[model samples]
Target chain A: MARIKFSTLTEQMFYTLLCLKEECCGMDILDKIPEMTDNRVNIGSGTLYTLLEQFCECDMIRETKTEGRRRSYILTKTGREILEKEYMRICAQAEDYRRFFSGDK
Target chain B: MKDTKRRIELYSFFDHSGIEKHLEKMAKKGWILQKITNLFWVYRRANPQNLKFSVSYCPSASEFDPSDSETKNEYNEFCRHTGWNYAASGAQMFIFYTELENPTPIQTEPSLEVEAIHRSVKKTIIPIYFILMLLAVLQGAMFVTNLISDPIDILSNSTSLFTGFGWTMLFILFAAELSGYYLWRHKAKKAAQQGEFQESHGHKTLYCVTLLAVFIGFIYWIISLIINSSYFELTIAVIMLFAVAALIFLVNGVKQFLKNKNTPAKVNMTLTVVSSFVLSFLLIGVVTFGIITAAKNGIFDRESQFYQSLYLDSPPLTVEDLLGNEELSDRYITQISGGKAVLLGKYEIRQYARSGDSDAKLPGLEYTVTVVKARFMYNFCKNHLIKNKDKTEGGKVIFADHYEKTDAAEWGANEAYRRYRSANYVNQYILCYYNYIVEINFDWEPTASQKSIVGDIFS
Candidate 1:
């Protein structure tokens, strides 16, 4: 079957999970995404957390600890798996596109 | 009025305040207050030509923003922002967009790093679901074990917390849990699809704990009974159950306390070393049991009094009597017995809960009678209410569940919307014997409304 690109909703979810892979809480997540993108993309705390929340809701983000004020999110095995498949999917799709249209390298 | 079907529509959940400040933000996205419906604010962008949608909230936008009146611009921006076949509504803050061919869930532009996390989350939940089911099974086994051993064990523990006034309420809770467990699978599907983290979490943890608590109560009984020589044994069993449940709560509570320190409600005196007082006072002397038994006997001087004490019908009918539809049911039903309306009608139980399937813990059957009220008999069988006693039917036994009067807020939930969302698998049943059906007495007040306001419009 032909591969497809990630939608914006999935993009928000993936990046939020990546940002949350480390010591990111709700506030940290709110901050890190804008910094990583250099202000190019900005999403609401509700929207960003809502997507990562789906991961947590699905038990994909087991909580670690709450330090001063924020609850931290760590990637679950399921989260890591989702990330990997999306990565390979992009790779496979890019490879197919290049092979058919742009040849070498 | 147009013969054409209306356009795409969707609804959203928001903190009432957040939606107020962001009305224009939402309005620009093609949402506006609904004029007609009660406690509902509608949002529509029909092209005036095709699509239609509605959103509902209790208070209108005027309740919040007094100054800025117009909301047209927000609707325009929403219409221009996306390229989709349709969008139904964007009420409060959530935007629900639908396309001609519904969009496949994917991220269009993702960095290599971001792609990896999604793959991992997918793998983790498979086992989590399994672990959750196992936990549920373990919890159910505990209830079964306890019921098989002693019905009085659960009754006593419940009476301790709720008192005699709580029997009906407790039964309701048990019933809700029993029935709710079946519908809980819907939660798994709904949680996976919707973006509400809190509801999803509640569904997961409550399920594990409900069955677990009953299990703890069951085990406590056996241990207490064996070590009955000492008053300390009973105390220890009670305290131990309380402690284990408390410990689980305290661990989670302490974390929440630290996170939400700014909120005053979080300052709740969550955990304490109150066992010292409990040990010192020692309420487990033979006096306590003597008093309870005496209360049971003395309060009901006559057999009629006995029925009143247990909130049962005066003339106890066998399961056969309730099932067979005897003629006496007609004689005593409509008359004004003693000053009250004698309600004796057997609702033909033709169940029609299309939304309720076998996957549902409760089959969602409603009694076809005077009216189907969600506030009646709590279902004990659903949460796999354990039966150590004789089964009237092949595997059914009747027990009173009287924990319905608990204020939802006391349980740390909003009472209006909580309903029986986290109840163990108990359903309210009308067990029919031969003729007269022993069901919820209409005189009995109920737990809060069976329907929840939390996700009412959408869920």
Candidate 2:
């Protein structure tokens, strides 16, 4: 069975939405992810291009400005909501791991 | 030494890993990828370097899209920032290369890559293959039907046999390609779920072998035609071949010209398709008109003095042998035609009175001799000839016209059948000998002596 689109955010998708919160140009997100993660994670250029297009189509991102071939985008309300849900899901998993390791019910 | 080279590469649309590895090898040999067309992949001379290559798909991109379209430009800008330089693109496929040792790859997500490849293949190769497979199936079905209904006609002609073989080979090739791609996709999707990119290696050997076989078959067909056909037939065949080549060249030229002028993708495609249909019809019309004109000019006339003299030179059996009239033999015209295929060979000889001659009412003799080459086909050929001796029309059998078994010893050592219509005897007989089935018809009934002569000459 195929995964439903945007049902759960992959690492690259999560960071991409996080970078677009500031209305940054599309190419800047490629570098911003690594900088924000202390060089721990990086998104490929082709991957970012395709993700941005798909995001725009699903109304998760909207174009903010255009300068020739360089375009800036900002996260939509739906995008922010999805990102927050994913963040909470990760925190819940961490809490469960901590509880099990500490021998707590 | 030439600085540019072109080769026909038979890479599947989704075989990105294979293509990338091939390009890397080419780069090491100092040939850099430049451009790709439907027929050829072109490369330019460059200094040898250990470069890394990536193949990515843009599902929405059209081959007719302008080179500097905004979407393509923006995509290129994104790649340039990551140190990946554009190499070449054809249809929905894009290739990039980088000199950096650890440059970021163009595609990193396995699932996304698979989705993009599927989209691109659906938009291009899938439909084309489906259409070709349908045509092949239809042709193969027709060939089978002909083989069942008229086995002797197909078995005796090299052209028909080759056509059937060619279509069968094409169907196998296309079916294998389609099934192979789908099976790969199935496995690749499972691998992608495990965060891996499955490698794709198509049946390149099958493609090469099928193409070579078809080419050899085509050459054999042409040679057979040349050996068996007259000059007029050979000329017509040459013209048809040239016409087909011209049609392809002219259509592609038009499409390229429009693309160069920055025509919109939809308009360019529409115009190209419309022009192809028009040009095809025009070429067919021209060929038909030329044939009609040639016929009007008596180019196909076989009754000329030259042809008459050639036909008069040799005839296996004549009416003179049966009627014992040497003077009447000079007024008769003879025609001989035959062809051979793998299964069998057939030749027909006809001797009749010349047109406009006072002896137009003279008797004529015609006979066809089928020589079965393969022992396995001998019984099949013999049975078909016997069964087909009866006449049928509009899905109903004509009971009045049929063959009745006769004594074999009269004709020679084998079986024989004489024809009858409405309780009246017809001067026709089907004689079966070892490896030969002869059907002979006479304007008048053949005497026992005449049958003996035919059995001796044709057995």
- Flag regions of model 1 displaced more than 4 Å: A1-13, A17-26, A34-85, A94-105, B1-168, B181-185, B188-459
State TM-scores per candidate: 0.25, 0.89
Task: Check candidate 2 and list the clashing pairs.
Answer: none
- The DockQ value obtained for model 1 is 0.04
Tens digits of per-residue lDDT for model 2 on B178-204?
Answer: 898898889989998898888988878
CA shift of B151, model 1, Å: 18
Candidate 1: lDDT over CA atoms? 0.36
